[model samples]
Target: MQTADALQLLLTPDDDAEPVLIDGLSIGAAARADTTDRKKDVTLEHFWDETGDPDDLEEQRWGVIAPEGAAGDRLIALIQPLIDARREAQGGHEVMIDRVPSAMSPEEAARWRKQHFDVSVELARDLPRYQLILGDLNEVPLALQQHQATDGFVGRLCFREERAYEAYVDKVLRWERARAEAAGGARFFTVHDRTAATTIGYRSLVQPAVAQLGRYKLDVADLGDQDEPSPDAFLEAVKRREPTVLFSISHGAGAPRGGWKTEGDQRDRQGAMSFGRDKLSGGDLGDAPFLPGGIWFMLACYGAGTPDVSAYWHWLERLKQSGHFGGQTQSVLAGLPQGDQRPFIARLPQTVLANPNGPLAVMGHVDLAWTYSFQERDTGRAMSRPSKFVEVVRATLETSRVGSSFRELLKASIVTNVELTSLYDDAERLGATPDPARLGHLWMLRQDLSGYVLLGDPAVRLPAMRRRLKKDAASAGEPGVRVHEVRAQAPLPAVGPAVAAERQAEDAPKLPPDMDIDDVERAIGKLLSGSPIKAVASEHDIEPKQLSALKEIYRKAGRAALGVK
Candidate 1:
């Protein structure tokens, strides 16, 4: 069976069977290794050198031990069973590993890693269906550096001291030996890439999206260097590139007031140089190129905000209206804190590229307040980007599936753990529950409601209910009959005087058929001596205007026909 089909079956399990087990170095395990009381000697400063820079110190700390409560633990717990079940159903395969000896001295660590890597490559040569994932137990690269590692091999060796190096070597040897013996049909390889703020940020936001979908594949490309390919270059390099959904993370901005004659605002620009027009106009956006047959996501802030100036809607609005993009495009996620763009940008690509459907939905905050948060108490969640990213993405995706529209999905997906309160809750506390009718009306006015749907409780099943109402309308030959269910309790009983008053009013004498306007007026004056205008209007089936007109007619003419007044 295909991987997608296998994964789906695994996710939606049968009633009778037990869930499958997924084994890996969980984020939680990594955290525990990093934080045990046994690591007291590993000071925050020990990882640094005479330069007194904390960068290297932080990297060494993370490399040695994982943080407490890493969000990756929760994610792995959620998806491991599904992966295991899928593998089991697909005629279970074994994973092979080449164990590297850690009993060797510090000088031999590199050689040990190289030997294992060669062995893993040899084993992988025969299996075309199998994929390899590799990791270096020692010499953590700068990109992977969470805080900062020492300056060089000499720094790291000195930092490790005497017993530290031996202990690490022993740990690596044991881990590799155990993995190699547990030989499966597949071979496990490790590749190390440095982590940047942007990549880390993107990972956090995309995790929720991935877990929410339950069954999907992800292809991650780290865009860390400014010197690397620009967004346009990456867009052009897509080969066999018929993706149904596309998402991008970059700096964005709005146009200035004086057309192209002035420098445009730097508010939302995602690092791309802007120079076409002096003031930057929507006209430039209209001319901007876009990919065909894919939805786009702009993780940058203010990219999709209202079009006060020409540049506001030129990019986002044009992309949606252009008919080339599939479902939706532009910045659906919120911006980063204090105008930092890394986290939001990191998640956009992860979310869009993972789903073959090409991002039918994009969920994110519009402001920096929502996108920025710390992973651990110290060293800034900003520094350990991926862990934070994984948390946000997972939360967003879970929320997105529960609602129909991006906003609703975002509101639903708003992650509110015991530790973190959601922005939606804050808005609610401030009394900002937007009128659902008004929201629907606005969407209708925009005429972009086809791809957009409200994200809310699935139990409501409004669309199905609406369809039933439509069917009833069609069958009854009534074009506009609306059928809906609303819960209401019986009203309270009327008070004693109110009840008596209602009875008296009901039993009052009827008006004379031959009475003129003057006679009727006299009767009303006598009956309603101190009653208010509201009571008079309620008693008669006429409006205030009709009552006034009758009163005027009575004053002008005598009661000649009835002869009472």
Candidate 2:
């Protein structure tokens, strides 16, 4: 067969074909050992059951975690109207908003999170469940957002200027106040990259999610297949007022085969959605009415933005060492923020949010995204677990808050963390090494889960829900749809320090009480000079785990401070 024909056949659509489960052969002996769970309880419903209806703002307070100093003050002032609206919605209650002094970058955010929430994330009850971050990734940091998301319904509001922020707030308020009407169904737009990731997402997630949404009596405009995923079609779909939710899957643009030329060029083009030979850049949308007042769930690498350092950088490096997907790995490497190019939110999302007619929220990945997120190997068998992905679609179509819907995806990560913690505790107790296979699997899952974030207000829901509620209210002869009022619950008692300390010691040990950033740097230098983890820990009067954790924290902080990844 011709090479072109062979490639086409391999990429042929097979709705009934089972997904490829096993990822690849192990790279080393350490990776061959298995210590993780065979079947992770990665269902989205479990998280919803535990967290309750985060969509109901009447019962849950909305919070904003703003940046510190003058910039934060200016941002808060720009969105003061939004705070007032949410407060009125909550029956004149104060919103839980605060500024963090040390969370401007991922490294600083990590330290802040470690100091506040610790390893296991448990938010104080008095704090709001629905949290909004009010700055760009560069201004507020992805680390702080991820930590808050571990337990709360969190989203962000980051735009290029004060006018854009004001415009977004206006767009959201107008969307909510507009009269409700029956709307078009959800739109499922997907790209056929011919790679396994896109193929499996199409077969497993797109097709299935479309079908499932139909079952919910929601209208769905299925825009999968070859010809429909172009930039023009995407724009047309966005132009229509109905279908307030667009769920798309695509390969985020990385680099030209030769690699990027300059940092400016890379930042401008990276993370654009690949539509065959055609691509969709944020600039392509202009100031046009794109997804006006709608919400989008974009599944692609850096669909949100590039982080300072990809969590999967070392893992992918190991894969490359094993001689796996060398070209693809290089492409991803080239796409990452390299050499003094500070992490920033993607241009597409930034432009869209800035546009007066753009989406209310854009849910996407902050780093390299792999099939590892939705596809998992089960007992030596590869399986597609699209439940979590599909649930987000369902929740959005059902008019749930975008942040709450994204939490459906976060549940899978939470499950993996529990399994990982269990494995670690077992290994520590039995003096046995955890299975390398299990460890790698759970680690990837956890990282992938943490990468998906919301880029808008956490409290915004689809306009379709508003129409439905209004329609119901009219039929019942009521003044309007009455939102049931509920009192804010008192703060829950924190976990006792003894238990918290014991858990911290078992996993990532806390830094020595007196050690500061400079002390951490010196300790890291000692470890780099061939000192064993035990020796370094002994010298610092800390556990080996503590030393290792401190080294990572210090390294990330130092690199970021030096304007390098």
Candidate 3:
């Protein structure tokens, strides 16, 4: 058994984190030890100072990592039983962790990750189709030397306290039991703006899927208008619908160190979803329900952690297309080498798992995410169906472990980028012109793979997908057609002939189909704030019912968005 002292010392992280020093060992500054309260204190040491909270646990893993050769083998021997115990409990799913052999140059590190990611990507090639991924996202030197962090690669996010992991597992088991008893099937909700080009590209490609793809009913809450996209709408939807799977897309809210309130600072909003003028910070979720057996995909920047600055350099070209260098300058500044100084703000995905009522697992980009990740070429033409991430995640929903799917998707993305790069170079050498779009996408794919991180139990399987909603031949001809299942009933709105006519007229308007609901609500707010509603509505061509829906949304959560009592 690992002693409290050994646990404390082994998990203790250095005050200053740099890439591997010449000697390979990080010179850590020692500090006070409290073996309890792992949730608040779990850290990589960069976020806290020695004089800070005295009860914080060192951010390092208690006993998972080990150097290559005999030492690593020994550590694995000790840890293998613990992991085996978990794998055994899961039955069908397996998570295999390999120690990173040694420290090397950044280039070598890239190769190292690529090699592992490549290995992970090959699920079902000769193995099971339900494969997932497992990673070691510990800090440098430690990660380089085969050590673990508070958060393991199995996708259980970060468990900060001594019993956090145990509690998380217990919750997962509870979720499994509930899933076994529940009558409903997998209910999924995805929220995103349709008007944004990136959003359109993503939704157009990812949303429409084979009806029988998974044992889940997919529901979407389109942002209708950015201003009208209320956080309440999402929360209410979750509360009402009780979606087992939730996917969100938007800009993440994060500012430099000083931009946040003391103790309740920017880290609170690091992976927060931007909703019109308002946002859903991790702190806001204190009142949210926990999705114990659920999986969340946060399609936003830094929803995980900011990866090595190199991850964002690929966007410079995309910025150059804006005909301004200011954005390019920021990209350059952001990507500038701040050696050994890794800027990692705590992320939202982990927060979701950390929540008492939060979900079982949340996967997201560690840094900025881009469109190229999901876009891939089949026979050399760009197409969006079956994105690497989507394929892996969907597989997990069916039969694989959370970590396996994440790892496999990550590997496929990385390998695809490498292949594209080689193809580009080959075309150039052969005196042939390479497609510029293909070249651009190559960078995005590579960057995306590097940042993709899953925070939750690697072994946690998505609730068994139940085919309860079979297609009705009379109303729907298809076999796997979707029909809403009644759970908790809500009162229907009072409707009259006049209201029916009004709704018909509203439905007939030429409104922007892609406008987000939140944006619509925001527009209504501006109107309430004394912007001529009739004139503005006419000019913008808003339909009557659409306009009414916006107002109704305001009624639901207007005061909060407007920032008043």
Q: Whose TM-score is greatest here?
A: 2
lDDT ranking of the models: 2, 3, 1
Candidate 1 weakest lDDT stretch, 10 residues? 461-470
Report residue 488 deviation for candidate 3 (angstroms): 46
RMSD of each: 31.9, 20.0, 23.2
Q: Using lDDT as the measure, which candidate wins?
A: 2
Tell me how candidate 3 scores on lDDT: 0.44
What digit string (tens of lDDT, one per residue) describes model 1 on residues 1-565?
A: 2211110000000111111111111122111111112111111222123342111111111111111143223322332333342233222432222222212332343343334322355443222111111111122211211111111111011111233223323322222122112111100011111112233334443433333222222222332234342333443422213322233443223222211221122222321211112112122222122222122333432322211121112333443464422322222211122232121122222222222322222322222111223222112112222233332332222221112212222221122121122222454588774333322222211112111111111111111001000022233433433346688989788765555555544554443443333324632552345334433432232355655555544433334223333
Give residue 344's error in model 3 in angstroms. Answer: 3.0
What is the per-residue lDDT of model 2 for residues 55-155, given as tens digits with 9 covering 90 to 100?
54545678788888999999999999999888766545688777776334445654565564333334444457788888876677777788677777888
lDDT of each: 0.25, 0.67, 0.44
Model 1: residues with Cα > 4 Å off, grouped in runs: 1-226, 237-241, 254-289, 306-365, 368-565
Q: In model 3, which range of ten residues has the least summed lDDT?
A: 4-13
Better of 2 and 3 by lDDT: 2
Could you give me the TM-score of model 1 versus the true structure? 0.24
Residue-level lDDT of model 3, residues 479-564, one tens digit each, is 54656666987866744544544454455444355454443654575456555455335323366566766665445343433434
Mind sharing the TM-score for model 3? 0.54
TM-score quality measure for candidate 2 = 0.71
